[model samples]
Target: MEINIPKGGITITKLLLRICSILIIIALVTSVDGSKGNSASPEESITILFTHDLHDNFLPFEVRRNQGKYTVGGYARLYSAIKEQREKDPDAVLVDAGDFAMGTLFQTIYASDSPGLRMMGQMGYDATTLGNHEFDFRARGLAASLRAAKDSGDAIPKIVATNTIFPTDDEGKIPANLQALKEAMDHYEVKDYLIVERKGIRIGILGLMGEEAASNAPMSGVTFDDAIESAKSTAATLKNDEDVDLVIALSHSGTSDEKSKSEDELIAQKVPDIDVIISGHSHTMLKEPILVGNTIIGSSGEYGEHLGVLNISLDVNKKWKVNEYKLIVIDDTLPLDPTTSETIEKYKQLIQEKYLRHFDMEFDEVLAYSPFDFTPFSEIGIELKEEPLGNLIGDSFIHTVRELEGNDYEPIAAAVMPYGNIRDSFGKGDITVSNVFNVNSLGIGPDEISGYPLLNIYLTGKELKTVAEVDASITPIMDEVQLYVAGLSYTLNTNRFIFNKVTDVRLQDFDGTKEEIDDHKLYRVVAGLYSAQMLPYVNEKSFGILSIVPKTKEGTPVTNFEDQIIYMNGNQEVKEWYAIANYLKSFDKIDGVPQIPVYYEQMKNRKVVEHNSNLFAVLKSPNRIIVTAYAILLAFVGIVVLIITLIVKRRRRKK
Candidate 1:
């Protein structure tokens, strides 16, 4: 991507002037792109325009907060802002930390042809790292997308992903998709580090994916090396092999707690020589560049919400020092660039004609009205506790699947969805199809469709309740992974043993009928495809301490649960957002709009919190799992008492 340094003769607006005075202009001078030391004095400065987690929000939209309504963040606004900054400092490098894809409907066709990457390339991104979300389409998908982008002949930026696990072992069968990905990674020249001479100074740039990001990218078939180790090795290569003056690490690791395992800040502390670390993956918005030793760490927030501008100057000692840092808001206040807007519209039209038209859906068509927010993280948020929104979704899943299937379909005892699957919350206004799309945007079906299918599985009542127990236990460890169940309400005794937290499991029906959950009875359950894949992993992630299994209704253990996955319609996987939109539209309209029933405006106590007033209360209505745990505890106590009694008898005999 080429940078156009505008001449001073160009017209400047008041907002640009204010931004220049407040955040843009810097006293320091530095040259951009080519040869070490030629024109600029040591006092000159260089600029780095950074953005992260854009997530395909190329159009500006209004966010109605409780305080007020404000428009924020789009390609046009961001382009205008970046152009203005470049006008002042022509040598500024535009780079994104990571996670620039796989959020919106635009990303649905990424594997075929990635418009997002093309747009970024057009926007003049100097370089960017591969974020966790980049792997959303899986190994072959990424390979295909990269190939597609290259084949498109768009001026895409340098995509650097250091510390990847290449997997060279020939013992077992390697998947074709994975093999294709490895080849594509090599063919595309996805590098660990690159040296670009900015003005007269050699700038060494390296990229690393953090541990969390690696974990999040389960579908990628690519594992990552240690973040610190990757950064250190790359820095060493750059400083020694390349002989660069400044070293920058575009780290998707992110700043985190000081003692946390591997974060951006930890990388900076461990790897000393990196000049600046642009952090990502954690979605942290650090307003000012954090100084750790000599390195400056900066991160902008997620979803094109903000742009980070970092200005640095060379000191007398020839060391780089941060002169300014701004996490500039990409709100409606900024003017839209006509060229970028035109490009964005072109893509939108293409998406409408090629994609949405098939489903009779428009990008911004209003589908329903929400009297209150149904967002995953709103007040009475689904993840915060058992919430109304979750209940609504769970109920919706059951309804949609049942309708899609014939009347003779096996009765589902309950339908459940993980809070992680529900992405965005609904605002207290008109809910558009796009809004619904935002809520459950992450999934792809077996048929290569855009959404995950709802799968039918069966589990013993004991195991079913255990699924809820997994929610209570894993919530603190994994944010938003908690399950929101529909068929039953389980009381959680926090004071009880970790894996044995849920109790009082009761089967609940849509008609409000309830019954005790039978321990031996196998009941049919429904879950989103993503949630189904994760069910087997919960026990593995918990170190096999919590043995969770979703069996068939006959109680036959499902070794390959993927085969059991069911589409709601004939060859049509359950598209979550579509299901949600259809469900909402099914609601009886008020004022000619399908108004949300007053039923969902508050919490739904699917999982009741039972504060253990005593040990007995904590262990009440113990399922087999809880009973076994309690027995073990009692046995341990009995053994201790027996030992104490023996010791006392011996002392008495001695006396």
Candidate 2:
């Protein structure tokens, strides 16, 4: 076919071609830079206000940093920040990533009063996910909390857990407590995903438990599917079946600066359809939004230290673009929400009446007054060193154990507390009973109580050295494994081989006297129930190189940690928090307040690290592990050299 055009005039076909080219250019420009072209689909925005790893901080708490005590975080202030954002954008969606319970004294009533959930409701959270800490009291407690929240007639946030699997028996029926949990979930309308329309925007939100989060919740009794796979399937449904315009993931999975370890970032990279992800679990505080393709990932710091505000607006291509993102610091400057404050106070009273009275203590009873601040919680695991706070807690364990055992007391060689278990540190002021509890307020006892009970185990001196080696080695890879001891001291040379970092180990008295550790002798060790339970797993974490067998005094391997619980009075479990509290109360009083002595004001050389690079220090006392590592390295080098020589000879012959 032939088309003819007049001299300088365009034919019908030419005119149509020109118009199509112009449209194509306009579309490309619009897609490339949203600001370039004008599209009929005007931009619309949706604001998301989020928090994670709140850990039941219903009231403002003190944090000692930079030689000063600063008051920060509380539900009331968090709600005030949320209200401010909502006022600016009424359609803003409020969400939490998880770990809403089990940190403060408020968690004492988690199963009974459901304060965490009810308070989130009052704060107007639209949706939330479950973090590992939510299951700290185990499945039954979680079920009870859910039931309590539902029965209270409070408007709790809708929960969406896409990957959380409720295990079934061989008969395809869930267990009793799990069944109860399932029923509560059903009653509360927990689902894989939820769809909400706000200001003409349809948003789909789904929640997921990350790999690390799931691993941390060993007692959760529920398993989780792969986060990426669950997210892929759920996002597909939200986009294809629900026909939603936006997909937001409320992932308890966390982000890291390292792409290999960042769970949520991996999810975004694998699942492109997800528009936004609210990350939690690691308690990361991203200063700015992380944009993966078109996806925006945001995380607020833990303990409600900050509230994340993510603003997204639709671009010319009908894709979401981040307009603004900021984390509002929840500090004393923010005015507290009156109703929320009152509700929290009511929960406090409930805690005092129902929980505190059992221990014969008031909510704010002063246990001791510290003249100097201990180690700040933020700096606890940053470096592998002796921490004054750890020293105090470990000493408290020994003190309580000795006092409880009284005449039956066997010398406690050491009491170990891992950095992971130390939740908070005391500032320079009156340390109240609440302060002591908050420091070790993790895990539940066999009595289904809030705190982890103390337990006694015996470790051979050889194994104790291994514990020091584990701290010196494993802590670099996993900081939570860092161990602090009350009656033990060890020196480590950092330049030594990986697992042989500890060069010296000894048992030290609190009075600064050192005693040699007999390698084959059994030493009684005291630690929190949870820490003792985790001691056996160190072998697995260390890949069989190091083994720690926690045994009874009669040399029987422990299977049930509950049986080892150290009791104070007849069947009353000696809770870890109470041990610290009792130790504080025993301190000499000055002017009616128990005074923490200056002894704890400095590090006690429990963990002395020699960071020398001298050849002698680096090569000093190579243990069996180091010798094996060297042999392996030499064999590998010899094989490589032989292969190179063979290759050169073969090439010469060919030439």
For model 2 the local lDDT of residue 194 reads 95
lDDT of 2 by residue, 407-449 (tens): 9889999999999998988888899888888989998898888
Instruction: Tell me each candidate's TM-score.
Output: 0.89, 0.89
Worst 10 residues of 2 by lDDT: 32-41
- Give the number of the best model, judged by lDDT: 2
Per-residue CA lDDT of model 1 for 244-329, tens digit only, reads 87788888887766557538878889998898888888878887778888889998887787889999987887667888899788
Alpha carbon deviation, residue 533, candidate 1 (Å): 1.9
lDDT of each: 0.78, 0.89
Model 1 gets an lDDT of 0.78
Superposed Cα RMSD, model 2: 8.4
